[model samples]
Each structure stands twice: as structure tokens, then as C-alpha cells.
Target chain A: MGKVFHEIRDPIHTFIRLDNDEKVVISSRQFQRLRCIHQLALTFLVYPGASHKRFEHSLGVMELAGRVFDVVTHPHHLSPEIRELFSQLDTDEKRSYWKKVLRMAALFHDVGHLPFSHAAEKELLPDEWTHEKITKHHILSDEMQEIWSNMTPPLRAADIAKLAVGPKEAPELEFDDWSTILSEIITSGAFGVDRMDYLLRDSHHIGVAYGRFDHYRLIDTLRILQAPPLDSKGEQSREPTLGVEAGGLQSAEALLLARYFMFSQVYFHPVRRIYDIHLKDFLCAMLQGGKFPTDVEGHLSFTDNEILVELRRACSDNSLSTSELAGRIIKRQHFKRLYERKPTDFQKNEQAALLIKQALEDKYGAENIRFDSPFQKGESIDFPVQLKDGSIESASSLSKTLNEIPVVKTEYVFIKRELEKEASLWLSNNKDDIIMS
Target chain B: MERNNQRTILLGMIKSLKDNKSWCGETHIQKAMYSLKTITNTPIDYDFILYKHGAFSYDLRDELTEMRADGFLSIEINPSPYGPSLAISESGQRLYDKYRENVSQYDPNIDFIATNLGAKGVTELERISTALYVCKKDNIFDIEECASRINELKRHVTIDLARSAASDAYKMLQEYEKHSC
Candidate 1:
């Protein structure tokens, strides 16, 4: 009999093939829970088509990671210097070992996300506890450990954990140089397969062209090369990192620009932001005892559908603050946008926005108003672009278009819909006092 | 005992900055502390890793919060182009003076770091500290190798900027060697 492999048809990646190991992970109760977790949370309320779940996204990431791994590790694709460094892993067996590990890491990356995704994270979890930390916990649990023990090579839970969270979060966790390169395949700041898959997958589901990018060309040009040391006292030893050839610079630009557009058009939509705040308020009230679940079992019991059902029950009670927030969402009674300031007016009119929020809050009550001011977007785009002449330069220095993209900051004052008229009139009359020259 | 030492080192650094009449932002403090520990070989244990800015320590952040609550420090969120600037409080200074004697052995190292790095802006400090961090992490001791590593780690930093950071880090290391001798 021919070797049988499990295959799932996906809208984004066409088909995601799973070996026995991957299938074992997918069939686990923890991984299956991701099906009920929405990829974009309440974003479906705005973009109705964005109802995709994390299950498909995890599979997509695994597939993209595999593609990138194959491209970077292939002898023909690697630069001469990089090839020499990987001489020990030259054999097909060693190559497959690393590939399997990368695929597994990608598959289990999002198993720790809480209900409603990022909306409830800040309120429900402790300040330092992120979804990545929870994911690491789950990866090291008895259930996952049992599965890893049964594998042919017996994968290390810590290795998978380090890759899932990346170097920024898991700085203390040590891994070998080659493993670091493999981990970068899934979680690196630039050219990570997680972002690559999400950008394309989110755009496809949201039915928008804003997040579309030349991922195919970008992946084809991906290569591994040593980055220069930071000081004279630094080691001269070559440390491999993920980078792209000069031909891929345009593709890289497209990927970054797509991220910027997606944040502006979809992720940070004003209505979406307010909905997130409401959802956070509800979750915070509901899970008041010790914030979030401390263990994997407590987390598995909660999902997107579970939370929605609880919200519906609370909406009928009317006594709870959670009920009031849930009722507004259920009845489509969203908060009114009392005032807004665009990026251009932010520098001159920030005080005006703040004063208006304070004045309106004093009159209407603090519970009825919220001032949302997001951090200014960062513009430091850093990625190595290997020139045709075997030299490398930062992509931002080479592309003026990349440097020209603006960092947008939007401030909004949201009021309860019933008090909108009074708030609007107060703002109109106090315009001179609120808005400073 | 180790935690106490870490706290003492932090307080001593803050006192040094206070003496210089200069306040720093969170990023500046983080990088400066990293440089101090690395250069002096002090046992001020803080797990710093390469973050977006450079070597960042969540432990240091938590410690600062605790110090603030205990009235040992104050963090003012005055708006600036870069971000908020953090300053030492009068109470913080008193605490530093009281505990600074505990870490007198490393006072020269702290003074060296504060005097050299105290007045620099957050961005330049980030570059230099990150340069030191990447060099140490990669075990690359050559100037050109260190600059190359930094440029790779921080793609936004130009080769020229990386070289400057490398030279600065080299000079600090030389000073540290001289002091140790």
C-alpha cells in the first residue's frame, strides 16, 4: 500500500498535507479548540466575510513555513558561504529532521490564544502573560509531551516552545545556532511565515485587496546569510539569518506595505476598535476572579462560541455590566463617534481631543465615555536585500517608496449613543476652548 | 542576596545619573544598565534579549515598577518626540544614597557608564548597546565583524551607523579593560 498522508483542502494554501505527527497534533483536543477561535475576533461584525478561524490559519502557516524551509535549505538555493556552514546537515535525513520540527512548530503556534483573540488579552490576562506564553505552557504540558515522546526522534518541547514565542519573548531559552535559524523561519521579525500566511489569508477572507502581496516571489527569493557583527569585540563567526535576494526587494516592499494597509483599513478600523473595547470590558467583568485561566485545561474549556453563548445569557439579565455591553453588541447599538482627529491634525489638535474627552466625561459620566489613542505606527523597516553582485544592503535605504509611507495615529472619542446629541452640541459650542491653535 | 545586589546596582546607576543632572527614558535606562553589567562583569542579574529597540529587560521594567510603588523612584510621562522621559525622584535619590554603599565595589564601573552614556539620546544609546549585545552574543571580536553583525541585526541602522556604534562599544570595552587593570 502506498504511504497515506492526511490532507485538508484550504481556501488560502489550496491543500495542507499532514504527516502522522502533524495529524496527531491536529486531532488533539487542544489543537481542535482553535476551530472555535475566530482569526479576527469581532471583525466579522464589520467585514462579514472575515469569519475564518485559527485552525485554517495554523495549517496555512505550517505550509508556508515548509515552503520557506525548503527554499532556504536546498543546496541549490543556498549561497556558497551558507552551504559550507550547513555541511553537517547536508544529508537528506538531517534536512528532513529540521523540516519536520519547523512544520510542527508552525502547527502549534496559536493553540494558546484566548476567546475573542487579542480583544480580551489585555483585560483577561496579567500584564506580562501573553498568548505566546500560554502557547509555550501548552506545548510543554503532559499531553504534548506524550506525543513528542512517541515521535521517532523525540522532539524537545523547549525547542518548539522557543520557536513558537521567538527570541524576544523567550530570550533566556537557549538554542543552537542552526535551531535559531530554523526558529526564525516561523517567528523572525522580518520574513516570518506566520505574518506571510496571515497577510494573504486575512486579505482573502476579508475580501479586500489591501493585504495582498507578492508572497510567491518573496518566498522564491528567500536565502540564508550571515549578518555582520555589531562591534569590533564581537565574534567573527558566521551566524545565519533569513534574508532575500535583490530581485525580491519589490516583493518585500509589497509585503510591508500590505501590512500597513491592513492595519489601517481592517485591524484598526474605528468601529472595530470600539467593539474591541466593549468586548474587553465584558470579558473583564465576566472573568473577575484571578483574571485568566492559569492552566491549559481551564483555557481549553473557553472558545469563541462559548463566550458568545455566555454573552447572550448575560444580555437578558440586564443587571450585570457585562450584560449591558453584550446587549449593545447583540442589538447593534454601538457607541457613537463623538469626535475624531486624523494623523495630520494630531500634532496641533491633541490637546483639543483630550479636553473634549474630559469635558464630555464630566457631564455624561466616565462610564459612558472612552478616549482611544493608539500609539504612533513605527516606520523602521529593516530587511537585508542581497544584490546581484553578492553584496547586501538594507531594503529601506534602497527603496524611497518604503521610506515615504506615513505612520498614522488616530484619536477618537466614543460616547454612548443615547448621549450623542448632547455631546455633539457641547463640542460644537466649546470648539474654541477644546481645539487649541 | 543576588536580588539585593541587583537592586543596589540599579539604585546606584540611578544615583549616578542624578548626579549628572540628566534623566533618561526607559529605553535609555535599559541599554545603560545592560552596558554597565556587561562592561563591569557585575552580577546584576537581568535577562535582557534583543528586542525591537535593542537589549530589553522585562525584569528591569518590573523592578522599576516595584521601586516606584515603594517610593524609591518616579517615572514621569512627559510627552516627547521619542516617548516619555523617566526621571529620578527626591525620595529615590535618598534611597540610592542609603543603599549605594552596598555596591561601592562597582562604583567606578557605574560612574564610567553614567558619565559616558548619560547625556546621549535614546536612539544612539540603543544602537551602541545593541552593538555590544550582538557582538557579545555572536562572540565576534573584530571591529568589521561587529559592525556587520549589528547591521544584520538592525537592518534600519546603516553601515556607517553600525561602524560608529561598534567604535563606541570598542572604546567602552577599552575603558573597561583599563579600569579592570
Candidate 2:
């Protein structure tokens, strides 16, 4: 219990407390690896203040999750029925469930992330894999199991991992059977603790106002609207209404707007896109060349510093050229935003991009243009809002503002050419052909 | 003429010249200027007319040659007797059409002229015969010249509407050809 006070200062929430058992997890070399992982990945290049580490971001997430639980179960403030519902779970199961959610969400949020978040995701694994899958693999691997064994609290890490993915993949490992509830709260629905924390934390560290919101009011408003049924079938029927109902329509609307603003102002910033591309290029080059340490390949486990060191080693061995790129990035030297053009036809865009790549290669000496589609998927942000009567309504349907903003994806890419002047001249020359409308 | 109105006239003139299969010359310029005045509903400025129509500022020769080298325009940049000439390659036509549409959407009012300017500067061919002649005569025998010529010939003889290289490519060429002559 005494160990839980180990203070982790977060840009958004300030100091986050790590429990004694959790401290064992945080202090583990595996957990400490997060220190080198930038919470926003390549966003630092765009937002100078966004150099915050994943370690702190994870802690902030953990803290927010804890707050969510507290808000839902506050004895004096929450409905007695919901508080009583929480009390039904044994201490061990409750702790395990909470720990699983907090740790998994914290670590896995950026797992799907390539070296520089979405930038790398687009370049390295556009059609193959996602950062979420990568993070999911890490949590499910034998290595994660080994880390789980070392913890003093004796958590069933495998069980937690199963809960992280929900029963769709690993039904045998689920103990608490709260997979649906956890998944909905963690990944989807408006009031998920993940967004609540990241919005504030990212906003604060990245020095943007988009993340600002009434977090405390949000927390205070939380109340579990539906109860988990005694049977699987019962749980199925009641799943949709299984969330908190504070702030009603107003808070939910604000969260949606907050997400929209974050995408526009912070996540989609052009400089961040450049940083993401370069970093991913560096990592992809290393990953493909079999240069990553034997322990980290296919299964990654390293703090932010270890990643930097590995990059340095790769450069020293001439397996990578990260340093040269790093110098440019650290100085905020970025690739220019030439133009934003939508693909006339998705199919032709692919073929034409290949031709463009060949054209650039001939002119610039080697591979320079990579095809990217960042806005291919319509990201769902429908947060389930529990009604006072124990029914659930999707935030989008309940709020007029949420429904009005149709998801308009800006699908384009950031091109890093070997010859900027020549490329621009060429683009200027062939503006009609190359620029998508 | 206002730049916007001048561009539409230029595009119309280019289409007419291509239809006649004539090199960009006095007649093409005269028609383009007349179209510009008609579109603008006023007397067109001569400088705007000349600049927009590739009269003086743009070295059509240099632009055409560069496109050929880059494999974008694919036309040969050669000085013909009818002033400077342009033959849009399949690639060049595709690019020209694309630029024209882009300029139109970017600023619909001025897009006609903007598209013409972009096509002239970026999408028009330098000279197909010169490019082919250089490659064939020099025995360097680059296939690009022949490909551009084939594409240009297709544009010259066949407007089979159905068989036109994708609409996007045709539109781009339409804008480029508008300024070429």
C-alpha cells in the first residue's frame, strides 16, 4: 500500500499515484521501457511541448480509470444500487479487473501506433496490420505472461489479457466475464476513460486547448446505467445500456467536439505527419532488415530510451540512418506540405501512386514517395449514454450537434521527396495530373 | 479580359486548334483573343491575353522538353514554323485534363484560365516530332517519344468519346490544349 504513493507527474493530471503492487509493475524494466515511448510519438516535432513519454501517459490513463470507477461507485453520491453492485465483486477480482483495464489501455493505446503514431501506421502497414494488433500481441505473448508472474500481487496476467481483447478471441481465459463492459468503455462509447485521459493529457503536453474539458464534471456525472446479468444471454441483452449517465447530453456532446478538435488541431498537424513518416521509415527499414534485437522482433518490449539506443546501434552498424534523420527532426526541419488532393478513384489512386513513385525514383535517384491513406476508415466515436431509466442511447442519436457533423475524411499523404525543388517544379508542371480533385 | 474569362476563351481556342490539327500560331492566338473578349464580355487586355495564352512569359520549348525528360508531358519540345508547337502525349493529355479539373474546382470562376496556364506551363508537350526525331536520329531510340506520339495521334484522329483515354486524362488535355495554341 505504501508503494502506491510513488508519484508520477503528468502534464494533464499532475501527480498520479502508483500502488505498491502496481509499482512493482511500473518499476519493472518492462514497464520502465515506456519512458522512451513518446505518448504522442512524432507529435513532438509538430508540437514542441508534446515530448511527453508514454510512461506518464499510461499513468495518467490509469489514474483516469480509477477516477471513473470512483465516480461510478461513490457511496454517498452514487445510487445505492450501483454501489451495492460493485461491492458484490470480491476484492481480488475487482483489483484484477481494474488493473487489467488501466495497464492494458495505457500500454495498448499506442501499440497500434508505429514509431510515430498514425504516420508510421500508414507507411509501414497500410494494408497489413494495425498498431492495436501489435499491442494486443504483446499483451498476449509468453513474455507478458512472464512479466505477470513476477508481480508481487500475483495477478493472472493471462486473464487480464483475455479481458483486454474480450471473449471473442480467448473465451477460456476470461474470469470476471466483464469483457464486453470493459471493451465498450475502453475502445468505444463516449465516456470511455481512454479518451477522457488522452484528451486532457495530450492537450496539456501538446500545449493545445482542444483537450481542455470539464474532466471533473465528467467524472462526477458517471453512474452505471445497467447491471451485468447473471447469465451470458442476459448480459447480451443488457450490454448496450451498460455505461454512466452524468452530464447527460451536454457532456457527451462536448467530448465529441473535443475529439473532432483534437483531430483537426493536434493529430492532423502537417509537421507531426512529417515526423511520423520519417520515424516510421527508420523503424520499418530496421524491422524489415532484421536489425531489431532478437527479443523485440514481432514482439516488441523496450522503453523509449531502449528504442533510441537500438536506433543508435543500428546506425552505428550501418543498418539504419536514424541519426541523420533525427538531426533534421530535432531541429524541426520538416517536409513541405505540397498540396492536399482527394483521390478521384480509390483504385486509380493506388495505380497512379505507383507510377508517381516510379517517376520520383527516376528523378530523385531512389524510393521517395510512399502511398498513404490515413482517412480510409470512418472512425466510430459513438459513446453509449445510459438513460436514467436504465436504457442506453448512443450519444450520436441523443445529441443534435453530434449527428450534424458527418464524418468527412481528408484522405491525402505527406510526400518526402529527395529533391524538393525539382519535385515542386515537377508538381507545378504536372499540377493538373498529379493533384487529385 | 479578366483572367477567368481569358482562360475559358483560351481553352476553347485550344480545342479548336487541336481540332484543326494546326500548330499554335497567329490564327490560334487571334481566335483565343477573340474568345477571351467574348467570354469576358469586355475588351480583353493584350498582356493578359499573351501571358495566359503562353504568348511570351512561358518558354514552351523548355517546359515541353522538361516534361518529356520527366516522363510527365511526354511531348517533344521543338520550335515549329507556326510559332511554338505542342503535341500532348497520352501522359501529357492525362496530366493536362487532371490539372484543368483541379484548377476548375480550386477556383471555378478563374479555373478555365488557371487550368490553361498550368497546362501550358506543366502539361503541354514540347515537340513530339523533335523528341522522336532526336531519339530516332540519335539512334538513342527512347520509346517514350513514340508512345507520346501515339497518344497525341490518338487525340488528333480519334475523339471516339467512348475510346478516349479516361475522362480525367481527356479533361486535363483539354485544358492544356486550350493554352497550347
Candidate 3:
């Protein structure tokens, strides 16, 4: 028989191996299209080395997910309670099937990226539709469904979709306990391999150290242990969840810190964020009806390559209506910072930057300003931690470092480049007044 | 639902859960809200999934966190290893008082959930609620089939316990339907 497994070199994973079934999926047009989608959106504009594609990042996620699956499902890794609860861990065949399904889910997770990935995702998509929704559409498409049907046990498209998007992104799918655990391994708020890979891979490509953490220690210590209840009323009945052993507390802390540093320093950098705004403006003007097509073929028809071509054309030719917007991307004449969020201002008004932006929009004309903020939703990192004596507790109560890590929030208002000096001075003079009023 | 309306329902639910002798943890609110929304068919819409061992809503969890940040809720910290429970602060109480009339319509729905599920721990709540979720979502009314489906969703649960859970859920559904708003 021909070799069933193929290996691809990855900067983060070293060598990512895939089986024949996965090889077929990877070679499909749907998966190949991800190669043209930029992983960090227009982040490369600021950090030039960060021009990596989602293709390799997805492979890295698959590689890491496979490792995590092995570690968490190994006999030694299974606690007696967990083993009793999930007999699938004891059943060799079931475990094998889930592992394969998980790797495939990880590989196909990002196949729905629009041209510039997440840069313009929210504004460009139709109402109630997101990249994750698009991913579900792609996975359920006829061509991909055929590949799933041909798998040894025939993987379900719905199953892959649940794991790929998790419960939050794909609310339509129902996840049982085992599916929830598998999905958590890929998409958990605390230690999902998807975040693990992107942090490592992004750090490696962007030449930054903020996203580095000890994955080896963290992975080995992963356990399906019960978490402590919030009160004494349910003290004895803890909920089983993905957690780490006492030994891995430091590694877990490092991961949280790494994410904070990356969000503050790299991912939410002012320049990088403004570029996303510019890209969104351009796409909104260029795409038909100010919306990208939700249909599979229509969505897959373009990527960053096509966007860049259009961008170059618009930059050279002044006839295009969005020529000015495209120039912001090609010529690096993007928006300049007029106001940044301040804690003091936030004390006066929680929507401090927003208030400032509204005031400035009135002053500078709404067309010359933009507002953007990184994800500020509640993304709690606290999880269960199993002690040496079989006791599980919340990580926040045990680890001081984990308890102290702050949620990263960045809010910015960018003005046209020419108005930066005047706007900055004016805002500096009227900053407090803007926030209070 | 409007933000104030959701908060009023949340604060009232928490207060009722406490009055009903529940621990009033976030899970208590989550499962109760699942019951409130799914069972009562109120206008409050939250996407709940069978997570951990029971129904969980990330949006609800985040809302609680957001409430805590906004001073509408506070974590009543406990001694070591025991997780903290949430309590409405003075500001939250004032807001609840201000919006008392707006949330009065949900009193019966809140009372029904708290009376039924308030005192139960996470494990019991999970099993019973999962059974209820299966019966409602899949429209599986037969006890044996419901038990079998629950087992498929939750393998850690024994067939006997699953059967018991399904029976309890079915009885509760019948009672709720008989007096549903």
C-alpha cells in the first residue's frame, strides 16, 4: 500500500503528519483556498515578517491538537473518576476514531476565511453570519461531505463542525459530554490547542517572544478533572472539566501571561489595529452591496491575493471610487491615533474612547475618523487544577500569577493622517472634558 | 430583551433562587435561566448548550462577569478551595428596585424554576436538566428512549440514573405544561 501518512514541515510544530484521508481533504479546493488568506489580517503591514498564511497555522493547530489528544487520552493521563465517567477513553476503537476526527476538525477550522481573514469579517458578512458559520457551510458542501463519507467510519460533518467552531460559535449544533470535551481541547478558553498554536506560530513568524509558553509541560499536565463548586451547598459535586495538574500551574500561568502580552503588544498594536480599520473601509466600498457573498463558491472566489491586486490597481489608477481607501493599505497612509483609552477617563465614562470618538467625529467630520477596540468580552482564564492528593480547585485561588493576570482591552480612535498633529493637540487639551461630558 | 429587563430578571432570579434555599452560584442562575427561557418560553433569548455536565450559556456567564465589572453584582468570596458565589450589591439592589415593575411579569417563571431547581447541586441539576433538554430539543417524550438518548449524550451516567433523570424531567415537563404561562 502507498504510504498513508504525509509530513509537512512547520516552524512551530517541526513536522506535522497527516493520514491519507486528511491528505485528500488538504488537497481539496476548499482547503487549498486558505493558503491565500492572511492569518493576522493586515498585521504584516506593521510587522513585515508576519506575512504567514492561515494554511500553515491550521496545520500547526492540527499538529498540536493531535499531541493534546494523545496526552489527555493516554491511560496514565486518565484519572480513575474520569476513566469511569468516559468509557470511550478505555475503548481503543472509540478513542482512535475521535482522535482522527479531532485532527481533521482542527485542519478544517479556518477554511472559511474571507479575503483578508478577520480584518473585515464582522462588517463584510451578512447579519448573523460569521466565519465560523461559513466554515460550517464549507464542511457541509458536497465535495467535502464526500471526503467525510469515504472515511473509515464515515466522519459526520456536523461532528467536525461542532469541534471546529465549538459551542459558542456554532450554537445550532448540540454537543454531548464527550463532544464538549473534544471541543474544549480545541477551543477551550483556558488551554485549547487552537490558541496554543496561533500564539506559538504567530510569535515565531512575527519574531516576538510574548506568545511563547511551555507547551510541553502544559500538555503533559492536562487532565480531565472535576472543578470545585462555587459554594458549600454543592461542595462534593464538582463538574469535570479540562484542567492541569498542580505541577503544571506555572506553565498555565505562563500561557495566560503570554496571551496578555501578545494582545497588548502585538495583536492590538495601534498601527496594526488601524490597518484593519482601513482594510474594512476598503472592502466595504469594494465588495458588492457592502457585503461578501455567503454562498460557498462566491465566498471562496477571492482571497488576499485578489484583494492585493485590486489594491494595487486602485493605488495606481485614480478612477476607482475606493482609490483613497486602497491607498491607505498600499501606500501605508493609514489613520493616525487621535485618542487612546485611559483608565482615568474610563473612571469618568466606561465608554471613554467612544465618547471621544463621537465628539471628534462632530469636529473633524464623521468621514475622517474611525473607532476600534480589541475583544473586551468576558474571556475568563480560570480553570480547575488538580492537586497531588486528588483534590481539584480553581486555579485563581491557588496560583497568584493566574489570579493577577488582567484581561487585555485596547480602545483607539484614529484620525486621517493629515489631521493627526492638530487632532492630537486638541484632544490632549480637551481630553478630560470629552470623557466627563 | 432589553439590558435593564435582563438585569431585572437576573437579579430577581438570583434573589428568588436564594429565597428558595439554592446556593445561587452562577450555575444556579445558568440552569434556572435555561429553565426560564426554554421551559417558560419567555422572550429572554440565550444560546445554551449541553456543556460540562449540564446546560451552560457563555453569554450568561459573561453577563455575570460584566455585571460584576459594572458593580451590579459582586463576588461574595469564601474560604480556600471553595469557589465564590455572586450577590447583588447595593447598586444592583437599587436598580432592581427601580425596575421592579418591569420584571414583575416574570415572577411566576422565576418562582417555578427556583422552586424546582434551586436547591439542587450541579450534578443533579446537570442530569435532570440534560434529560429535560433532550426531551424538549429532540421531542423525545418516552422515558426509556429519553434515558437511552441521555446515556448517549452523557456516558458517565449509568442507565439507572439516566432512567430516573428522564422520569423526573418528564414529570416536571408535565407539571410545567399544566401551569405554564
Candidate 4:
């Protein structure tokens, strides 16, 4: 009686609906290829239950987008153009289409995500390149376009895909805005759907209680306020703005708390970081040694299994005694969870990095010492929230939870046996040189 | 200083104390004045007599002397009684608290919930029940017991409340995982 739609039961979002275009996209060989992509990459090595794929997460995001659209567009008189999009839905079919588009967006959101997730990208690429850029390329590639051709309003598939990633310069559409939307779909802010979905989803999968929230009330409170541009001595620029009422401030507050709890409770968990670091190191070694084709970098078409295969091969070839280790990790045999400490001051951090680098070089030699600063640029985009006063503010400014929500910077000293015995001594001796948890 | 400039100076002073965690004596004040010029990229006068010193000086002790007499802050002067050695007044603490309070209000619960619940109607006890089934292993709970609780609470609470309570219950069970361990 509520709504009869094609609902794909998901761990994050209970049910993700597939639109006609989304269905086509999802059914496509290229889109389905995302099923092989793990959302958190090598994070599963840290949190074994984090084995969910980008495909599943994308579906979750799509479902979340549909929920956002419902809240943002309804209760207020929607513009005719916006209304036209939803005109056909007398039944769930109409609703299903919206769900599908969002689903497709969510699914492909991380399609360009590298092997072992962000870790691989951090190790391999320069600072300027992003997973989103790769995602855009794959979506526009011939294989995907061929599949996209079958979608309803197929002509817009490319545009939407382009919209999802956005451009560097201030093109017709800013990547800032689209990326903002995408980030909202993924990260937790006042009203980010990604946070919304993951809170419930991660809680469900990880068997934790702290990630639950009032999902529907949040949707109802997504108020849209109108605002004018700052052009003086010209025709009044009228643009309808988005906001959630001050009364909904508590909901926003609750969201920030949940994000903090999740981070403390789940994401930044020490075991997860270690697992990720090992996977990252393994992949980097393989890529650096030219053991695999660089085409993987270009296409990035490898699945979780393919990465594991290469990792296993590398361990064997290097006489690394990591074959059993690789098998356990690939098979979800995970490590014990450890600490999650808030980051220290920025100056202290830089100083710590410098000291750690020096210590590593002193003990393990420059070539052997590898320091991976995972907090590279463009990692966490600020979530923008429309305040009660109708002005858009960055979530960090609005919420205190993010004030010291440490930018994940991991410094790992891969200790071979020769240096293993000295590693503890070096770490103890150089405590002031590095930021300890 | 003009009111705006004075306010800015006061805020900057408070921030310096908060971040640097040190008392701004004469030497610290001189250093601050120099650094402020560098940071602002502006040329400003550094010599000004603080009322407490009853004369112009480059030392922060002079400024603190005048500010204290004006009640801008309350401080315990050194044995020389020239400048404050430590402690901020109620007014300074008020300014510090304002920023601190604003920053401490962040909560991610709403965002987490919204994205996870698809189509946004999963709020009532019945809906919560459905969602519960999806989140949990099929045979983990005694469905009958959960349903009875839902029925009893159906008239008393909103769906959101129901979902929250049920979620908490589930979380408690999961947190105390006996079988998996």
C-alpha cells in the first residue's frame, strides 16, 4: 500500500530503487563492473565486515538521493521544470526512475576508485589526480557509453555522469557544486545523504548500535529557502535556496554526534588503518616493480580479487613470506582493532612527520623507509549546509565534531626482519619525532 | 583603537592565549605586535603607552596594565605590579566560551539516518519492524516478542521514536555479541 517499486535490499540503505536509465546502467557490463569494486578498498583488512562493494554503496547513494529530492522539492511549490521531471509518477514506476538515476550515480560514484580504494590512489597518483576524475573517464568510455545508450533519456547519461564529477575550471557547471552533492551523498554533514545511509548501513553490517538516526524526519526537514545574488545596480537575481529550519538544528546536531561516534567507533579504527597500509604497500610494490601492466593505472579495471592475485604473486616473488598473510587478508581473515586518537596541532603534525622521516631514514635507510601521508589534498571536502538564516555555511564551521576530526594521516614504517628488532627501539627513542596515538 | 579594531585586538589576544597557552607579558606582547604586522601585511605603530605603566612602552605589560584598570580583563599582576602574570576575567572567558560553544554543537545522527533509510517513510513502529528484519540475521530475534513490543508502543510513540528504541535494543544485543565471539 505504501509504494510498489523495484526495491533492492541493501545493507546501508534498506532498499535502493532502480530507475529505467539506472536499471540500464546497472545492468550494463561496465556499470556492473563496479560490483567488483570495494567501496572502502583495503579497509576490509582493517574491518572485516567492511567487505561491501562500491556497487552496493552506489545503490545506497541512489536511494538516498531519491529521499533528498523528495524532501527538497515537496511541501513547497516546485518550479515547473522540476515538477515536469516527476510528472509521470502516478505509481511506483515514476518514483522508481528517480531512485534509479541516484542509484546509477551512487554505483558509478566510486567506479574510478582504485584497487584497495583510496590507498592505491594515494600511493600511485600525483596530488592533482582524483578517483572522481577516473570515474568520469570510465563513464564516458565507449564500453560504458554503449551500455548507457539503452537507458531512458540516454542522451543525458553522459551529461549526468559529467555532472557527477564536474570540471576543474569554472565550466557551465562547477565540480565544486556537483562534488558538493556527491560529497553530501557520501560524507556526514548537516544533511549529507552518504552520512545518512552509512550511519544506518554501517551500523547494520558491523553489528553496532551507534550509527542509527531518524532518517525520515531528516528528509521532511530539508527546507528550501530562496535567496538573491549579490549583484547591485542590476536586475534582481532570484534563486531559490535550500535550508533546514533552526528547529531541525537538533537533528543536525545529532548527525554530527553520530559521525563522531562512527569515526571513534568504526572508520578511523587502528586495525583498519594497518590493514589498509599493508594492502597499499603491497600494491605500490607491485606497481613500482613493473610486475603488472601500467594499463591497470589507466583503466584501473582490476577487481578486489585481481588485486589480491597480484599481491600474492608479489609476496611469493619477493620471498616476503606474505603468501599466507595475503590469503588471510583476501579471504577476510582480519587483524585486531586498535586505537583512534584525535590529531594533534597542525604544526606539531608537520614537525612530527619531519622527525619520523628523519628517524626512519636514520634507522631503515631512505630507500627502505616509506611514509604515506594519507591526508593528501582533496580527501575530505567540506559539507555545505544552508543555515536557518538562508546563508550557506561549511559544515566544519557549523559543527564542532569536525573541528579536530583528524585528517587521516598514516605514517607506516614497513619493518623487514632485519629492522624489526630495531623498530621498537627506534619508535621509543623517536617518540617526540612522530605523533603517537 | 576604534571599537572594531579594539574588538579585533581583544579577540586576537584571547586567541593567542588560547592557542599558545601562555601569559602575554611585555616581551610576548612585543612579539605579538610584530607577528600581527607580518600576518596582516600592514605597517602599524608598535609604541603605545599603557595606562597601567603610565607611559608608552613596546612591552605588553603596559597594555595589560591599562586593560586591567579598564576591566577588559581581570589579572594578578607580578610582584612589580606592572602587568598581569596570569588568569582571564569573566568577560574574556565569555568571549572564549562563545566560539567554543558554537564549535561543540556538531552532531551527525540526522545525516547518518537520512541516507540509510530509502524513500524516507521508515519511521513508524511497523516500518521500524520491517527495517529491523533487513538489518539483522533472519533468525537472530524472536520476531514475536519484537512485534508485541511494537504493538504496545504503537499508540504511544512516533515511528522515529520506535525506530530509535528498536535500534538501541538491537545495538545492545550486538554489542554483547556472545555467539560470534
Off by over 4 Å in 3: A1-4, A87-91, A151-154, A234-239, A376-378, A424-437, B3-24, B39-42, B65-77, B87-118, B139-148, B158-181
lDDT of 2 by residue, A1-437 (tens): 33445777665777777656567656654456566667787676557788877667667767777676555544554444433434324476675556555555554444433343444554465353555555566665676667666665555655555444433333344222134445445543456777777788888877778777787777777665532221111011121223447355576567667877787677766666666666665666556552333233533453455556655565455334665555445445555654444345333442344455455556655545544433312233334465656554445445557544333234333456445676878866764564242
List A-chain TM-scores for all predictions. 0.92, 0.73, 0.97, 0.71
**TM-score of candidate 4 chain A against the true chain A:** 0.71
All candidates in order of lDDT, best leading: 3, 1, 2, 4
DockQ of every candidate: 0.07, 0.01, 0.38, 0.01
lDDT string for model 1 (A260-378, tens) is: 78887888788888888888877777875737785888889899998899788888887776778788777777898888874333334435677778888888999999888653232
Q: Chain B of candidate 3 versus the native chain B: what TM-score? A: 0.93
**lDDT on C-alpha atoms for all candidate structures:** 0.75, 0.47, 0.82, 0.47
Q: Is candidate 1 or candidate 3 better by TM-score?
A: 3
Quote the lDDT for A426 in model 3. Answer: 91
What does chain B score (TM) in every candidate?
0.89, 0.29, 0.93, 0.34
Residues B1-109, candidate 1: write the lDDT tens digits. Answer: 4555667788778767657644465556788899987887777878788763567676686676555534455544332111334556666665556566777898888
Expressed as tens digits, the lDDT of each residue in A1-437 for candidate 3 is 79978999877877999989989989988889988998998898888889999999898888888988998888887777777877666678888888988999999999888887888688899899989899989998887889999998799888898899888888568776677888888877689998898888889989999999999999999987776655566335534578899999999999888888888899889999999888888989988999999998898898889889988998888988999999998999998887777766765666678889998999999999999877545456557788899777777667667655666666889999999899888988998887878
Q: How does model 4 score by TM-score?
A: 0.55
Would candidate 2 be rated incorrect, acceptable, medium or high by CAPRI criteria?
A: incorrect
Rank by DockQ, highest first: 3, 1, 4, 2
For candidate 1, the per-residue lDDT at A240 reads 59
Which predicted model would earn the best TM-score? Answer: 3
Q: How many residue pairs clash (N, CA or C atoms closer than 3 angstroms) in each of the candidate models, in the order given?
A: 19, 30, 0, 29
Q: In model 2, which runs have C-alpha deviations exceeding 4 angstroms?
A: A1-7, A73-153, A165-177, A226-237, A240-246, A286-334, A342-366, A376-378, A387-392, A406-408, A413-429, A433-437, B1-181
